[model samples]
Target chain A: MTSALETADNPQDMKRIVIEPLTRVEGHGKVTLLQGSNRSIQQARLHITEFRGFEKFIQGRPYWELPVLVQRLCGICPVSHHLAAAKATDMIVGASELTPTAEKIRRLMHFGQTLQSHALHFFHLCSPDLLFGFDDDIRHRNIVGIIEDSPEIARQGVLLRKYGQEVIRITSGKRIHGTGAIPGGINKSLTQKEIRYLQGDIGQMIAWSQGALELLKKVFFEHYNYHLGFGSIESNMMSMIRADGAFELYHGGLRARDRNGESIFDHNDYRNYDQYIRESVKDWSYMKFPFISALGQENGWYRVGPLARVNNCDFFSTPLAEEARKEFIAIGDGKPVQSTLGYHWARLIELLHCAEAIAELLGDRDLVGKELRNMGNLQSSGTGVIEAPRGTLFHHYEIDELGIVTKASLIVSTTNNNQAMNESIRKVANQYLDGHRLTEALLNQVEVAIRAYDPCLSCATHAIGKMPMELNLCDDDGELIDRLEKRADGRISRTI
Target chain B: MSTDKTFRMDGKAIPFEAGETVMDAALRAGEYIPHLCHNPNFPPHGSCRVCVVDVNGKHMCSCTLEAAEHMEVDNSSDAIIDKRRTLLQMLFVEGNHTCPACEKSGDCQLQAVAYHTRMLSPHFTHFFPKRSIDPSHPDMMFYYNRCILCGLCVRVSRDVDKKSVFAISGRGIDSRLVFNSPSGKLGDSDFSATDEAAKVCPVGAILPKHVGYETPIGQRLYDNKPISVVGDTIAKNHSEKPVVIGGPHE
Candidate 1:
């Protein structure tokens, strides 16, 4: 798999391959492949084109509004931004602890978000590629296709997503852009009626989530070599862990581990993340590259989200998910799993964990407590961090004495995985494109690499829309030679 | 006799008093005609033009146009709604109206009006005009970014509060709310936390200090229901509630 291509004999000829508007992702992105003389792959990079400037525009606004304001960042994962901003604003008001009811409700809301986002990604976005094969007709490779081929599974995916959305609506007051969360605490608590409404569907949601996991495991075992080796690259892992070193999603301290399953850092406060993480800007892409501070830039890049979280944690607090984690680890021979495609497996496990956790929270009595808010004095600076479905999200703010935000910065999940994503694209380009004539199918393999990360370029850039990606290939002289564009309507056209 | 004196608004006969404007009549009848600058408590200042309605054959500000009997008013027509959306888009672009980050979001008339009109995305180019915030006042803040230049504060301060503390200066795109005080700050002006003008702002331009987010979001005035059902009267009533700090249950 690591062998260099022998197709290129002449050292002077050059060609370019371009895939414009990559399909089935969350926002706008393009992959460019530069082929050197004789079909030898020279370079490949993913470029995020959209920009919203949330960090810059958020300045001068009141710190109290950040939680609701930042929800406009990404329509798909607004809850993550809402909770992260709320947590940051909680720090701004100097509230170290919230009422028990507020804490539990927030956790429940976060878990709901994870379930919905993972379901949408696994079923709506990536499943078509897995179910129909990567090179299947692009027309029949979507949720609509799934509905035609397997109606029961497709319906289950939709219903499971609806369950998560219902949980959000009950807690946050709306499905798309709710405003229940506020600084220091949430505005309201769950009532008996709302609790009962959510409880009615939990059993069905859990069964469907478990079935989704089983289906993924079966697929992985069937295509074992492709599942283990496709777009696989070695990198460090990062996630938030509870103080007791259990799996945590909503609130916890930072942890980083090396590829050899060795701990680099254990459970450090999120407020002090600057000491361990630093973001470096690149001229090519609008997204910032974040890496570990201690390791230097070259080896500092680490992966996050489900794959990282599953690999970095010692055990999950939930029972079934913990058992699944043990089997997942066994697949890696008691070592960190480096396969990029393992992200699908890891995501299914998390879906199971979120389902179990939501059931557990629903049983807790503190979810409906009346002490819903903690009115605290406003402080000048605060930081909030949470595990967004995609990865760890950070929201930091500096307020004036009058409570207006003076400065703001956010590091979204996709931004943290920038280096690893680019590396995976390059690896795939070298492995598949070298010594072979470029085809639309071969270029799609490159996109399959990115789909594994489930990158939300919209959240990373704080922009909008259903992502349509384009891949472009150019010669050494910078002329576009081959172009593949995936239109938003799910049609693929190749121009050479 | 009442039916004889009624004027048609979107094909529904809305009865009106002798001297009331179309907006006043609509409000009293519990019908919503979207408006930004016209408040029933104050004389209509037709500057915002968000309440423009087609009367007979011509478009006019519903707040200033008297409700003539048998008049055909196109309040909910597609053409009228599209024009209102354009006007809303202009308001969004001309000033920095960040609804998501504003204190008056759910309760805000501009935001509610936009929602009522089904204005999905701000289609126009964003001007991103630079504006200043006046936090010098001890009891209130003047966030100039959210100002829509409706002059409600000016009218309320002059006619109701008897302070004449606010006025509009400049012209066209440069127009902005100015303080009557020499220092041009709310602190130097005669404005108080209790002034009627403080609660008259339709947007978040003027806000009381230290009392943000007192009401939880879901129970807030516009969270559960659309703005049209609440009508203008209820929105004004909810916006008039005094800002209370450190209250367990206001």
Candidate 2:
């Protein structure tokens, strides 16, 4: 594949840029460009490598076990996998018609999972770059950096996240692959004591969340250049819209919208997902791309995640969340604010909103003592859709007469966002690079773009097997001018 | 049996506490309920809705209902037996409950309860959601397929163990057990081999995979001996720990 692009050194060669292992992201992948002699990216590739057959291993198991079974996907968002799996099971049992109490608790838990996972992404995983310096050594760039640099704020973030996990534990039987949520209904009943514990922490969590919001405002306003340096792109966005036409996570219809906030699709039309989205396999990467099905592969550009969600939804149910979305869009709604930089701002807003919602749900006495598992015995197919910390997640399953899972399908958030990230990076790399050397700053910019999605490779690949990643740069003549030698370890070798 | 109307407790005919759970009174009177979910530490969540007993009117969950006076509590009532059978049916339907393939099929509490109630067939439909076996923890195996979702593991971890390692997630029929950490597998979870969550699972779901197949059924739960009689000695001797009468800790 590398031997295809050998070419003469001309103006076109001068315009090309290459980024490898897009930095600061959850998994590994790279992007490359071929200039059209007019300094335009004539050929672009979003290359990914690493594969494991999670779907294959889950085939023989009983359908009811999917919640715990699918949890091995990603360590960062095991709750997302759990939720998706539960939804899949529900589909097998046809349990989508949940009672109001069941719905509320489900939403609360979903919001909690989203909140904690996003908090971990921002404060623990991605924030250090924006706060300290993007080029800081990999060793000094993690949650500990926040602790060492800003102890008070880091502690607040950690505690707030812990509170979310606590809620997950209290509601479900466990924090991660909870057994509380079942095919027919929940396993455990909620109690007044649990409600009290959740209520008591509302004030503390709210304060901490507000502190994060204030910090985001300071960074955005104070460090204009830093914000500008992050990548952006123009693409379509998708998310869940509640029955009342507000932003929702737990159980709702999916909505796809363009940059102008026009609803292109909505109203429980998931069976047509393949029509709107087309997944394609690339040799270089195991993760599949979901392009706009109507426009066809490369032309169809859609994104999923915090940035995409905010762009797609008209309003959030919670007041603070609505306010945050407005503020976020105000920055650059002009052309779908494609820069991955916006992911940070959007994520903080979600974290803030989730905390507030948690407090509200816990304070409601009705929610506290309502029957947890009213519909525990039944057999029907059901569907579950929620916005994971990364983006929108869909779980669909079909069961046999015995209520065993006959088929299972999942549209993970990260996979949906793959194409968008690829397109977004190409745009950013094209706009900024001027046939310059592969500077660390430019490389960091590309990395931040991928990090914005907070993709979880662990969740994407469940089977245990080695998948190799190779990087090759070619010139116009289809000759491999530079090729990274394959080494026993994933590290790129200089021998080639 | 029909003439008695109620069983004698310590030779005094106390009207079974109207809805006063037989298990509660028995425990209150320094007697044991011999049930796993009936944790004296906390109110029973009733995931393992065993401990069924007969009130004057009908059979009910002993943990949830209050005992009433003069209630002819027939713990051995045919109605009580039928209710227990249904409860086990619910348990079996919720997960991949393959008793024959289960490691805990022998010494399993779910199996013991099933035997006590004479559950010949799992009448309810099976929601055999695909399960993941967590052999990740070196010393134990977590067969999520056989989990009854009793919340005992969750309760033990949070209420008694203080680790808060286990939890349940999703809602309605989609619910299943989860771990605290990101990787939902037991390997990545905060649970240790000795964590209370691992220890409290009553079915083959959270079995010590190594020990299940080593024993047989008759010698497994009843062995023709009533649980009340065998349970007393086992409770004092720590039945899980191997011990001959002349052996250490035996």
Best DockQ goes to which candidate?
Answer: 1
DockQ of 2: 0.03
lDDT value, candidate 2, whole model: 0.62
Candidate 1 structure quality by residue, lDDT tens digits, B186-229: 88999999887887788888888754565656776677787778
What local distance difference test score does each model get? 0.81, 0.62
lDDT of 1 by residue, A1-496 (tens): 1113213343235565656555323446776666776667866777766577889988877777788888899888899999999999888777888999999999999889889989887887778778887777766766678889999999998888898998898888788778778888888899888888898989898889999999988888999988799888889999999988888998889999988888889989999998999998777787788989898777888999899999988899999999999999888887799899899899999999999999999988999898877766778888999999989999999988777888998998988888888888888888788867665568668877888886464222111122354566666677776666655565567756
In candidate 2 the C-alpha lDDT for residue B50 amounts to: 75
The true-versus-predicted C-alpha distance at residue A26 of model 2, in Å, is 8.6
Which docking band does candidate 2 fall into?
A: incorrect
Please give me the DockQ of candidate 1 compared with the native complex: 0.37
TM-score of chain B of 2: 0.74
**lDDT for each residue of candidate 2 in A1-496, tens digit (9 for 90 to 100):** 0111223235344433454543313456556766654545455555565444566665544555666666666666677777766665655554645555655676677777887887766666666766766656544544666778799978887888888887887766567655545554454545788788788887888778777877877877777765755555557777777777776666667787765666667765564565566677676467787766666665565778887777666788778878888877777645455557777787788888888888788766556544543333345454556678888777666555434455666778877877666665665556664354434445455556666776363212111111132344556565555554322222234434
- Stretches of candidate 2 above 4 Å error? A1-44, A136-141, A223-229, A282-284, A333-336, A374-381, A432-434, A455-496, B1-250
